[model samples]
Target: MPPAQSALVVGAGAVGVSCALQLARRGVAVTLIDRGPVGGGTSHGNAGAILRAASPIADPGIVWKVPSMLMDPTGPLAIRWRYLPRLAPWLLRFIVESRPERHRANADAIWLLGDQAPDAWRRQVRGAPAETLLSPVGWLKVYSSEASYRAAEGGRALYRARGAALEEFDAHELRQLEPNLAPIFARGVLHADGLFALNPRRLVELCAEAAVAQGAVIRQAEVVDVEADDARAAVTLADGDRLEADRLVLAAGAWSRGLAEKLGAKVPLETERGYHLMFETPERSLNRPVVWEDKSFVLCPMEHGLRLTSQVELAGLEAPPDFRRVETLIPMARRMLPSLAGAPTDRWLGFRPSLPDARPVVGPSPRAGAALLAFGHQHYGLSLAARTGEVVADMALGVDPGFDPTPLSAARWA
Candidate 1:
């Protein structure tokens, strides 16, 4: 394979923009195409946590709780009855991947990318406007009960073994750290190296700007189809225009499955619809992001307001936003922080492109010689964006990526 002279990247979210930036930096003529303005999709609505010490999604404990969580409308997880049939196949695979051995393997792979996330971001945003978007204040996870806190010991141990700097705080110490939190929280674990984005959407936009400054072209058009031969790839736009390039990178987030399939890889990808609520007039502001263990949500002080974000709804992409999921977060937020005031000023719903095994597809497409697959990042898309872009660029430029790419290969499904 020869180094690609030109590349076409689909989707303009974090992953796509990062890929464009890296490709442009390598002197490759790159065109980034998206339906709307940058960061308007899932990349805009996250909790703004640059979580590098994130745990794997294939936990056996969560598998046992799935049934009850699905049945409870107010629980952390929900599934639309109408989408159940379509979601069954992915759900079954999700369970199979929860086996102890598979779970450990997936966890190790995830940690490898996650542990390097901070450095990657630092290198990517060194002198760019995006540098101001990040806050390295660390993240705190609080538990309301002793048993729940004890159950998290295994995860704590795993993270510690992976070289994460962690500190456990008792109820008194936690209260001293964040005086605004309610007294109900009995224990807390703080990831000392955690980073948060004051505004996640703006971060992506700035990255896009930097890419443009580096000579990447941004095309505000939707990609309808893509075709590739042995030597080059062509992307057909919704307006019937076509673009030919030496390589194609699919980083389209939740909408990537169809595109990947066209490249000859059928990924078991599902849309994990997530909801969030933003409070405009919070009674108090927190110094860092906090995750409630039992509730499975995150409360972070953003540039606009205090954002309460979490919930995994197993509904297909086309379904309407169930505002109840957004509404449910208010009471939970109040319970955690009694000082929270005023009604929610904003509500959002975004789809996280998830895979059954919890690992993203980040290498070459088995079927398409000139195409590379880079989506299915699930919840870690924002955190893993820079590293993924670097790896993808390395692959496109015929350079060594310094590690085995087998773990994230799209051929695993084949």
Candidate 2:
């Protein structure tokens, strides 16, 4: 297939906007479309920390842990019992991905994107107000239990093997690093190269602005249907109008699987419904994003206030939001940070586009040469958006992306 001259990118979240920015920078005419405002989806309600040392969720032995995790009401992982039947196939694939060999491959693939994330972000936001968007204080993961801390050795070894910058801290040192945090932690690990966004939604908006400045068009319309052929790709909006482009990129995050199937790639994409609670703080609380390792939640200090982001509910897209999953974390959050006592000011529920293997589908559609796949980023969409954008742009422009994207290809499911 020839290089695309114009492209239609669906979704205006971090990944889609970043893709539009990269494509526009490469002189491709781009139309970025979304039903909601920029970043209003999962991109808006997240911890906002880009963890370089973070590993894939489907770690080895996770298969054995899922049942207990599902049983625990306060556990980080949850599944709607009614949705279990519908989610069985995806869960089976997830179990397969949790095998040691598959886990290792997925971890390595995740690191490939994570390792290049920071530099790609810098290049993407070169002329934008990056300082206002990003904080360099890094990410902190605190463990409250000795057993949990000990269980993290494998991940620590993985980080060391990957050459990711991280430092371990004793309980006293953890308290010293964040005085506001209670001294309940036994150990802490600081990912020194991590970066956090001050306001995640605004970050996506800025990326869209940057892309528009480069001649990319932003459209607020729902893509009702999509089609692709050897020559061109087109999308039909909810209003009955069709938009055509030389190529089509589906970066629609959680809502991408069906459209990808329409484009001739039947990917086993599932949504990891995540929830977050926002509390108003009169003053700044923490220096950076801090995660409770055992609880699997993060207390991120954002521009708006302190955010308690956590949970992985396995409800489908149409399921009602279960605010209780996040609401139950309040006591734990208060135990971690004594200052977080008042009722939450805001509660948010968003869907994370996840694949069983913990890798995104980031290359060309299997049977449609004119269509590209770029979703299934899972939890690291914000972290890997810039790098994924660069890869998508390179692929669309017929230029080398500098890395083998085989692990992230949808054909693995085929």
Over 229-320, each residue of candidate 2 has an lDDT whose tens digit, in order, gives 77799999999999999999999999998899999999888999999899997353899999998988999999899999998999999998
Name the TM-score of candidate 1. 0.97
Q: Write the per-residue lDDT of candidate 1 for residues 88-168, one digit (tens) a residue.
A: 999888888888888888877776678788778888899888999888988899999999999888788778888888889
RMSD of each: 1.2, 1.3
Candidate 1 — which residues are off by over 4 angstroms?
A: 281-283
- The RMSD (Cα, Å) of candidate 1 is 1.2
TM for every model, in the order presented, reads 0.97, 0.97
Predicted structure 2, TM vs. truth? 0.97
| lDDT over C-alpha atoms for residue 141 of model 1 | 93
